[model samples]
Target: MDKSHNLERHLMSRKGEHNYSATVIWTGNSGEGTKHYRAFSRDHEITCGSKPTIKGSSDPAFRGDSSRYNPEELLLSSLSACHMLWYLHLCADSGITVSNYSDHAEGRMIETQNGSGHFEKVLLKPVVNIGTSDDKDLAKSLHDKAHSFCFIANSVNFDVRCEPEIVVG
Candidate 1:
C-alpha cells in the first residue's frame, strides 16, 4: 500500500458542522460558586463544576468553582481534547490501540496595540503511550496519519505535535 494514497484519502474526507448549547446560573455565597456551567449535547447534559482549587473546600459549592479551569484553559483543553479524539479514532481505524493519551497544551496571548491576539498558535505536545502488542513502526505511522486527519488541527494554524512513547505492559 502506498503511504501517500492514505494521506490523500484522509485529506479528501468530508467535514461537517457541529453545534452545542450550554447555560450557567450563579448562586450566592455557599449555595453555588461562580463556576457553574451546564452543557447539553446529544442526549447528555453535563453540569460542570470546578475543582476545589478555585472554591475553598469550606464552601458548600467548593466543587463547582470555576477557579480550576478558566476560559483560557477551555481554549487549550478543547484543542487538546479534539486532537486526541481525532487521533484516537484514526488510530483505531488503522488497527492501532492506544493505551494512554495525555497532552500538555499551552498558548501565549500577545497583547498587541490592536487589542489582544487570540491564542495565535498553541503547542499541543501529546505523549501517546501504546500497548506492547502494538508494533513500533505501525504506531509511528498511525500517529503521523492521525496528525493529518485531525480536523481541528488542520483548521487552526496552531502547531500541534505529538511526542509518543511506547510502554509494553
Candidate 2:
C-alpha cells in the first residue's frame, strides 16, 4: 500500500445537524478551588446552566467572573484544534513520525471601530510544540501547509498568527 495512489482530499462541516451542540458541564470546581459554571445553546432555551448568577456566568480562563468557555476562547480552541488535526494528517501523509504535539492559543480582543463601543480585533496566537523524526524542512513545510489549510483560520476576519517552533527528539 504505497502512498502515491492514496492521495485524496476531504471536506468537513461542524454543527451541521440542528441538534448537535457541545455542552461542557461545569460542576463549579475549576481545579483551583474556584466556583465557575456555564453552558452553550443548541436551541432557543438558555436554561442549560444555573441561570441568573453574578458568579457562574463566565469562563475562568477568559477572566470571566464565572466559569463557562467564552465565545472568544472557544474561537481560539477551534482554530488550534483545526491546525493540530491538519498538522498530524500532513505529517502522516508525508511519512513523518510525530512524537508530541501541543498548542497554546491566545486571542487579543480590542475595541470595535466605527463608533462601536464593544470589543473587536481578535489576534489569534498559536504557539505549537511538535516533536518529529522527519527532516526539519518537511516539518516546517507541514506546519505551513496546516496553517494554509486550516478552515477555522480562513473563516474568520482576524489576524491569525502561528509561531511554530519545531523540534526533533
Candidate 3:
C-alpha cells in the first residue's frame, strides 16, 4: 500500500467522539447545611459505572480535608496517564521495548482576587525504563508524538509540557 494512502486511512480511523460519565455526590453538608460560610465540609465521592468510588475534596487551602483527592490532583493525573498511554503505544509501534514507566506531574494554577482560578501550565516528568539503550533517542522523541495524541492534554487550554527521562534496565 502507498504510504500516503495508509496514512490517510490511519488518520481517518482515529477520528471519533468518546463520551464519559461521572457522578459527584456531596457528603460535606454539615448539620447547618451552608447556613454559614463554614457550615459545610468540602468532602465528596466521585462514582463512575461499576468502578470503585473515589473520595474527593477541595484543596486544603479551601477548607477541605487533606486526606482526600482534590480536583487539581485528579486533573494532573489524567494528563499524565493519557500521555503515558499514548507514549507506550507509540513506543511499541516504533520497536522500542518498554519495561516500566512512571510520571511525576505538576500544575500551576493562578487564583484571581475574586476567587476564580485557572491552570497556567502543567509539567509532566516521565521516567521510562526500557529493555535496552540502543533506542534511547527514539524513545525520547516519542514523547512529542504522545503529547500530540493525548486527549486530556489536548482538551486542556493550558500548556502541558513533558520532560521524559529514558532509563535502560
Alpha carbon lDDT of each predicted model: 0.59, 0.60, 0.91
Where model 3 places Cα greater than 4 Å from the true spot, the runs are: 1-11
TM-score of 1: 0.58
Model 2, position 83: C-alpha lDDT score: 88
Off by over 4 Å in 1: 1-17, 24-68
Candidate 2 per-residue lDDT, tens place, 1-169, comes to 6552353423332324444333444444435434332333211112324554221333444345434445556577888899889988887877877777777666776645663332244333344344544677777777778888888888777777777767776
Candidate 3 lDDT tens digits, 1-169: 6543564588799888878899999999889988998999999999999999999999999998999999999999999999999899888777789999999999999999999999999999999998865589988998998999898988989999999999987
Clash pairs, model 3 backbone: none
Give the TM-score ranking, best first. 3, 2, 1
TM-score of every model? 0.58, 0.59, 0.92
Q: Find the candidate with the highest TM-score and give its number.
A: 3
Which consecutive 10 residues in model 2 have the weakest lDDT in total?
37-46
In lDDT terms, how accurate is model 3? 0.91
Clashing pairs in 1: none
Clashes of each: 0, 2, 0
Q: Report lDDT (Cα) of residue 12, candidate 2.
A: 39
Q: Model 1 lDDT vs. the true structure? A: 0.59
